[model samples]
Target: MGIEYVSVDAEYPMCCPVILCDICNKQLTREGVALRMESSTPQEPKRSPLYFAHRGGCYSTISATLEDLYGSGWLELSDNLKDFMTQLAHNFNTPLEHEYTQYKLT
Candidate 1:
């Protein structure tokens, strides 16, 4: 048998918009959203299509990624997702000692 190419749909819908925050969106004329795609072939199984999460945070799926971009002036994050970003920032800023202590104290 010869090597046959196989195509598959992405886990998440592709070409979806990456809505950033208000300011960056307006400044860059971007929809505050980005696009992602994964192309692969059967012969090269390792090359199978994968989730190419784009736009959110330098291409990170984690919603907070968008926030980082927004904070860095790379993209604008929407108010709706701001809280998500806020928590993300808080988490990053939190020290490991505090994290461990929080559970212990509780």
Candidate 2:
């Protein structure tokens, strides 16, 4: 599915609006990612409900979902998807050398 940036607000079972991780089922308190499925129609693209998850482990669950939907080489099909995955991976799993720098900044 193609990616589109959109603002979201969620309020249902909870009194206060909160986004929960689709994998872990916990409230997301910091950086997270949203994945949505887009319909084939370009004129009237119907998007599925957003799948929200934390950027590190939870976000990696999308890889299995994507592979199941689009086969194993899903990332190879689109550079945009690959870049997005790369950034998410880097967010929580930084290299040892960069860890100190990242911790300092954050």
Candidate 3:
């Protein structure tokens, strides 16, 4: 999985379209984190819709799901994803040093 940006066209009086969290099913704001994931089976690989989650708890919950599916080293599998998460952690002022040891770039 990796981070992705999305945009939508909204009508007058509407500033932006609302995105709901995939984990909690609540409205996702600008502070939310969105990830694009792919699933593969014996036949083919399928692209999944963006998964949205709020920072902190919601983010952690979704992360656990990813870990269960892809194992604990999932974040370390992709350099791009690791970099993105590192930047996100800094931007959100959320320390991920303990939760994600690989988040720090060598």
Candidate 4:
């Protein structure tokens, strides 16, 4: 009985006052930049997409984040990364870290 996470967005608002990283077991801090996290916990056994925030893009952060996200065969990525990236031609210039007061974009 394991849990799964789907990180649709690139950041998360911390629910817990003291949140720890699944990889580092250290405090997860979103000092200024918006942090990365998965969406929900759905129980499924497969590949998944994962993103993490650490001390200013430290090299070790990448390795550790991957291991934690995909190690035990819990991760499920519906699309191939290369194919997705290639097809994803448009770019989002910048992202703002703020709460949306309204639901509709237009």
lDDT of 4 by residue, 1-106 (tens): 0113334345874343333344444444442111222234433222233433344443256545555754432222223233333333332444545433321111
TM per model? 0.19, 0.44, 0.41, 0.23
Task: Look at candidate 1 and tell me the lDDT of residue 26.
Answer: 21
State the lDDT of candidate 1 residue by residue for 1-106, as single tens digits. Answer: 1112223346744453333332232211232332212222323322111112224453454335433433322222233344544664797988644221111110
> Where is model 4 more than 4 Å wrong at Cα?
1-18, 31-47, 56-59, 64-106
| Model 3 Cα lDDT, one tens digit per residue, 1-106 | 2233334444444354355677877665556766544333424434343466777898789889876765543222122333545665686976433332122211
Task: Please write out the lDDT profile of model 2 over residues 1-106, one tens digit for every residue.
Answer: 2233323546443355455666887665546666654344445533244466667787788667765765443222222234445665797687544322111110
Top candidate on TM-score is 2
> Which 10 successive residues of model 2 have the least lDDT summed?
97-106
Compared with the true structure, all predictions reach lDDT values of 0.32, 0.51, 0.53, 0.35
Root mean square deviation (Cα) for candidate 3: 12.7
* Candidate closer to the true structure by lDDT (higher is better), 1 or 2: 2
- Model 2 residue 71 CA deviation (Å) reads 6.3
lDDT of 1: 0.32
lDDT of 3 at 66: 72
Q: Which candidate wins on lDDT?
A: 3
State candidate 3's TM-score: 0.41
